[model samples]
Target: MKTVAFYRIGMIICTSSILLLLISSLIYNLLPDNDIPQMLLLRDDNGRIIGDAPFAPSWQFPFGTDREGYDIGYKLLEGAVYTIGAAIIISLLSFIVAFGIGIIGGFSKFRVKSFAHKFFTSFYFIPQSIIAYNILYPVIWEPMEGFTTTLSERIVIEVLVLAIITVPTTAILISNETEQILGEEFITSATVLGGSPLFIFYKHVLPHLKMRLFIIYPKIVIQMLLIIAHLGFFTLYFGGTDVCYTPFCHPPKPFIQEWSGMMGTSYKELGLSWWIFMGPLLCFTVTTLLLNGIVKCIEGLIDHEPYKSKQTSRENETHSFESHSKQEKFLFIKN
Candidate 1:
């Protein structure tokens, strides 16, 4: 059989997951409530309710349901946009900022690079999840009266906070990678050949950097996902949390059906019903696995890509030299 790229498998899995989630979200919006099952309790053939809502994993409900009778699977599908979509957005924003800063740090003087490197290196010691939770809790958690900020505004603030916290660490890694690439002899050779900084970078440096960025991008996405999940554990969910602070303290509710939100709200069910917690937890695990798989595939692709290019170039050079040598011999010593 011919060789097949590992990245294609990753792409298929990723694309199918996203499309499934999008379709579920679309169906949720377009279809009526009756179309989607919301069973209050288990019913017998006689149509008499036997058990309460929040059913366990059964033929009727594969993933099970929450206390409100909403299917865990359906909620996951609808919330995929909020969860994965937001992770992607945050990662992209963080990447853009880190990439710009990294380019400067990579190209700038020793002092600038050193300061940046040393300063940002300190952030690595602090756990990202803890930082995200503290920063997000105040803004997203509803007060006694109600939320001061609108849903969109709160989401924007949360996204920005998450993106910003990641900037320091991501930038440092990018800067280091850039520095390594710039240290290559070809870069110096290109410079000696009178290549402009922009030209040398675009032609030689960028191709290498692109591979690193590809590897880095998915890693950042995975990181953002973990941070968001941690925030969820703290009940600092995205789209804000609505808490009831009355005499009977009702549990906080999430504005969206997000995976993290699902986990945050249903974590208490771990004692009473473990399946609810498992639903979202499994989702996060699968998503993380997929992202990690993508990372592996990309690394594999990068590893082989250079070898293939070098081999091809060598073959071409040898072929050209052999042809030229033959031509010279024929012309110099013809009978």
Candidate 2:
């Protein structure tokens, strides 16, 4: 199949998965909370009671049951909104901060631009996962003593930290793009005509950046998802982890039922009930792949004409600068 065909196929699959998750969440919310049926309850052959038993995939429970006897399928459905929604929110916030800093720095005087470039360049080298984890650890990690934070508070802190960590790198990218746009002859012409900075930016830069934003936004979402997964692997699930003391003191439990948290909380079952880990792992993999596919589609649709024009304009600008320098040198020699 052609590359574009593959992208289209990916887009379809990804879109369908997202839609299914959305529908599932909507249906789940519509049902009265107390009226929700227990679908993953298990009983012994002689009808003895067993709490939270593990089971493999079967006709009745397609995705199987976790160690807690919760249906993997149901958990996935319930957590989809939080998992995907959080990533989208973080990505959008990142985009806003990035564009704001980037546009301002790109158009600002030399000192501001230089400082922004250097700062982000240095920050870009540090691993984003590490940064996110450190920032969140202090806020999310429950101490052995002192007051504990509420779920809503932890969620707020996590989302804000995740969003903030992305700002520097994203802003650098926007700054570079903005600088290139500023170098174009049209931008210079607009400035020469007494166009205010805001007017010129709105008229010239934003239109060019809109398509670029479409391409970059999905990538930011994917990055956030990966970071969340990375944090999950470390048992630092979003919304923080809860302490459990039943059947011996177990590891902290995830407060949110999102896929990453589910995977983190259920990781202990990897040996006993592999299905639990696999279920959320599969969801994370498929969701990220779908996002990646969408990105490829957008990339394929990107118009190269603007890039070509930008390149040409940059070369013209360089030549003009050189010519102006030569004239200055000739005048100095004549004097």
Clashes of each: 0, 2
Output the lDDT of residue 171, model 2. Answer: 89
Local accuracy of candidate 1 as per-residue lDDT tens digits, 263-287: 9888889999899999989988988
TM-score of model 1 vs. true structure: 0.86
Q: Each candidate's lDDT (Cα)?
A: 0.80, 0.78
- The local distance difference test score of model 2 is 0.78
Give me the runs in candidate 1 sitting further than 4 Å from their true place: 1-7, 30-36, 307-335
The most accurate candidate by lDDT is: 1
Question: Each candidate's TM vs. the true structure?
Answer: 0.86, 0.80
For candidate 1, the per-residue lDDT at 189 reads 58
Alpha-carbon deviation at 69 in model 1, angstroms? 1.9
In the range 106-178, model 2's lDDT, one tens digit per residue, is 8877766786688779876888999888788877766666227788888888888899999988888988888
List the candidate 2 regions with Cα displacement exceeding 4 Å. 1-13, 33-52, 244-247, 303-335
